[model samples]
Target: MSNNTNQAASDLQRNELPAKKPKKSKTLQQSDKKLPFLLLTPTFILLAAVTIFPILYALYVSVMNFDTFGNSSGFAGLKNYMDIFASSTFWNAIFITLLYTALAVSIEIFLGFNLALMVSKDGKAMTYLRWLLIIPMMLSPLVVAVVYLLMMNTDMGILNYMLQSIGLPKINFLGEPTTAFLSLIFVDVWQWMPMCFLIILAGLQALPRDPFEAAEIDGASKFQVVRFVTLPMLKPIIVVALVIRTMDALRTFDQVFVLTQGGPGRATETISFLMYRASMKNSDFGFASAGLFIVLIITIIISTMLIRFMNRSQSA
Candidate 1:
């Protein structure tokens, strides 16, 4: 009876003992699952430290009549915002930005769409063409601006020489207000159209070939096939390209800054340009903060609406 009791107790103890853990590699793999998050924590902290802090600080400063040195001389409440609304310069900047964005994005979409279609139809030829297309995009925007500025110079520009050679009279590309704004628009389109083309081309390539093949078999005209099959399938890509291009064009600063410097009587000065002037040139920290927040809010709202509209279109 004592032996039986001892044997039963031993069995129970063995049952209660934990199973041997997995080998070291397995143990390490389980540990590694948590390591990615641990690693990401530092990045998250850094982003919050750099980005979030400045944004919050800007909001706080916008309510105050702070001077250039960030010295809080007085509280302005909504006075800064009210003044911003009352300023005609602000309205002009807004209008110009909208106009530039509209024109640039429109031209980019049209040209990019055509370029993407042509590239998609080509075979080995497209490989070289694609690289060529990407060169403008790869070049720094500042570099592009400088190159175009030299080309568009009223006096010694090669562009004018070429136009004169072609029996076209040379017009002031950057010296006149209307021509300057149009020149800025043209430069923007030239620089950014490649990106739009690449994006749309990728989408075109991703499409299954069966629908087009079927249309071909059914004796569908090329136009009919494109209208029915290609356009519908490519809608999402088109929308994405439009949104991205629009956003970039709206905040257009680098090209305009380097090339025109918002010159010809502030004709090309965008909201971003105005913000830069307020913050850097004039050193009105409070007003700059308010303007920045306003721009940020507008961007968020526009992006949100675009996303929602795209989602609905995709679902439909």
Candidate 2:
């Protein structure tokens, strides 16, 4: 019996399998480390060529002088920047750009939030209405400007016709300074309010159900719920929308260029339009580069501040 037991134990020990070892070869490890870098190399090279190269070239151009017939004379050592800084037109362009940004962004945010609140409920009607609202966003900015130009024409315009039919005086929307500025603002609002509306509406819809339930249990009023709970929750989305819109607003040129050509006496001339005129119309690349570099610097600072603000909001 003892001999039989020992024989069974020996057979069991002989049949058991050994544990497998993990693969730890140096070649496999090296390939794994190189894979991500190899994948990123193409993207990195493209960015350097497209973005970095142009910026560096522009910086180089900004400090040079242009001779008659539009050739670079030589390095001017910040003279172009000094000249641009001393010019009143540059300051006016800056002021107009700021004014345009403030008014357009403010109106869009206000009207968009209200519109979002109105259409936030889930329904087939809302879905169709959303499609309608996004139509302007789908249209090109230049196309929108051209359409508005036709609509606001003095002799045979639809808006003037409607006013005349209603016994109201026809307003020259694009031919005067005050009205032209207002017209630009109204046009910009018409084109971009939908973007703000869509963003805010999405934010409203994605709101967590628990908070609203708690608010209801606490018997919070509708206004209170929106003011305290909804707005607080929507802050991050609002900041994101604002940053995007603000950056685009700072570089507004396409619509204004196609519509006004910075006309009606520079009323709607933004910094971007000013740059276009300097480089393309006037054939002064040095001046344009200097002014645009300043704009680029300001844009960088503003973008940094907005990113920092977003980080703080996330942390809070």
Please, what is the whole-model Cα lDDT of each candidate in the order they appear? 0.88, 0.88
Judge candidate 2 against the unseen true structure and give its global Cα lDDT, from 0 to 1: 0.88
Number of clashes found in candidate 1: 0
Clashes (N, CA, C under 3 Å) per candidate: 0, 0
Clashing pairs in 2: none
Q: How accurate locally is residue 103 in candidate 1, as Cα lDDT from 0 to 100? A: 92
Stretches of model 2 off by over 4 angstroms after superposition: 1-21, 24-28
Q: Give the TM-scores of the predictions, in the order they appear.
A: 0.87, 0.90
Q: What tens-digit string does per-residue lDDT give for candidate 2 at 55-131?
A: 99989999999865679998899999999999888989999999999899989988999888887875775798799
For each candidate in turn, give its C-alpha RMSD to the true structure in angstroms: 4.3, 6.9
lDDT of 1 at 299: 84
